[model samples]
Target: MEIETTGIPGCYVLQARLLRDRRGSFIKTFHTPRFEELGLRTDWREEYFSASAKGVVRGMHFQLPPVDHAKMVFCLTGEVLDVVVDLRRGSPAFGTALGFTLSAENGRGLYLPTGCAHGFVSKAEDSGMYYKVTSVHAPEQDAGIAWDSIAFDWPVSDPELSDRDRRHPRFADFETPFVFDAAKAAQ
Candidate 1:
């Protein structure tokens, strides 16, 4: 696996090696030791997959403290416009956004730090997205910025969204608690 940092300090774009042959292809999406060597949080507590139809938007979401999370995501069976935003206060990239394509064909994945918000718009019908999360789901701690509040130009205008996602706080109203500590990050 290959990892590269994104504009957001702790966010990363990882590409897994895909070995192709006459039969098909093989790729190992996650290897604990490599993640450990990279200093990434690999203590995943739960894993889940979601299948979304085109034009569906799932987030700009993260959990609040005491249950904050780090995630590694992959577009497994199709394509999506994956986006992440830095919400950590005092970070150089705070409020900045990064958008990119994650497709099964490319074998690309994203690593989101505890304070970053993540969401995706399916570009292909029946897109399958898989996640390895460091924290368990906590309904009471679920939090996020509104999908439309940031300057990101999502490809879809009439996006399908859940009620919870639709009701999240807008960027201007969000009170973010995470901070970037270089010392801690280096460890």
Candidate 2:
């Protein structure tokens, strides 16, 4: 697999090899040693998959500190416009938004560090998104910024959203608890 850094510190685009045969295709999204070599988190405590229809937007979410985690998200089927925003106050890229197109055909995954928020919009029908996170879901710690608060240009203006997502605080109103550690980020 090939790992490429993004504009946000500690975030990466992991390109895994895709092998195809006469009948089907195969992909290995994770390898302990490879992730170790790249200094990426391999201790995934929880995994989840979300299926969404085209034009569905699900995000701008993250957990608060104490349960904040590094997450790796990829498209298991179909495609999505994955988006991330840096929330660490001291980081140079704080409040910066970056978008990536993750798809089954592309064999790519987005790796986000602890101080980032993530969300994605389904670009194709019956899209499935897989996630491997360093920490388990913590309901009390669950948090998010309003999706529209950022400068990202989402594909749909009136995309569908859940009531919870609709209630998230706007970016400017959020008091972030995450702190950017330059030393840890360098690794």
Candidate 3:
């Protein structure tokens, strides 16, 4: 796999190398050594999958401090427009967001640090996403920034979203709890 850093600090887009033949294809999606070299968390406490239909928008969400998690995400089937925003207060890209097309066809994945908010908009008839998290889910710490609050140009005009996501507070209305520390990051 090849890992490439995104504009946002601590965020990465990982592409897997596909070995193809007449029989089919094989790809190594994850390997601990490569991840360690990149300083990405490999100690995941939980794993989950979500399936959504085209035009469905899922988040702009993250958990606060004690439960904040590092996540590795990829498209298991179909395609999606994955989006993330850096919420770490002291970071240069705080409040800034980035979007990428993650698809089964492309065999790409994303690694997101604890201080970022994550979400995705399905681009295929049905899309399945798999993710590994460094920490378990904590309901009390669950939080989010309204998806529409950020300056993003979503391809879907009328995206299907859950009531909870629709009710999330706007980005400007939330209190950011994490701060980026370059010193700590280097460790």
Candidate 4:
């Protein structure tokens, strides 16, 4: 696998090398040694999956403090417009976002560090997404920035969002709790 850095610190676009034969194709999505070599966390505390239809938007979410996690997200079956926003206070790109097209066809995934908020908008009829997290979920700590509050060009016209997501506060309304620490992240 090859990892490419995004404009935001600690956010990466990962590309796996695929092996193809007459039957179909195969790809090693994750390997511990390789991730360790890149200084990424692999001891996942939780794993989750979501299935959504086109125009469905699932997040702009994150966990605070003790439950904050580093995440690895990939498209398992179809396609999506994955988005990550830097919520690290005082960083150059704080409140700014980076967007990418993630799909089974492109074979690409994204790595978002603890201080980033993650979400995706489905692009195909039945897009499937899988994610691994370094920390487990904490419902009490669950929080988010409203998807429409930030400056983003969502590919969909009327995205279907959960009531919880729709009620999230605008970016400017909340004070971010996490701050980017390059040294800590590098460790």
State TM-scores per candidate. 0.95, 0.98, 0.94, 0.95
Top TM-score model: 2
Q: Candidate 1 versus the native: TM-score?
A: 0.95
lDDT of each: 0.89, 0.92, 0.88, 0.87
Candidate 2: lDDT of 156? 89
Candidate 1 residue lDDT tens string, 1-187: 9998788887889999988889877878899999889998878999999999999999989998989899989998889999998888888888998998998889999988888899999999889999988899999998988888887988988899999899998998998988877654411
| lDDT at residue 52 of model 4 (Cα atoms) | 98
Candidate 2, residue 167: the lDDT equals: 98
Q: How many backbone clashes does candidate 2 have?
A: 0
Highest lDDT model number: 2
lDDT for model 2, please: 0.92
TM-score, predicted candidate 3 vs. hidden true structure? 0.94
Predicted structure 4, TM vs. truth = 0.95
Candidate 2 lDDT over 113-135, as tens digits, reads: 99899999999998999999988
Per-residue lDDT tens digits for candidate 4, residues 6-100, read 88887889998877789877777889999999988887899999999999998899999888999999998889999999999866778888899
- Tell me how far candidate 3 lies from the true structure as C-alpha RMSD in angstroms: 1.5
Q: Write one digit per residue (lDDT tens) for candidate 3, span 135-180.
A: 8899999999889898788888779999999999999998998889
On the 0 to 100 scale, the lDDT of residue 150 in model 1 is: 86
Clash pairs (backbone) in predicted model 4: none
- What residue pairs are clashing in model 3? none
Model 2 Cα displacement at 94 (Å)? 0.3
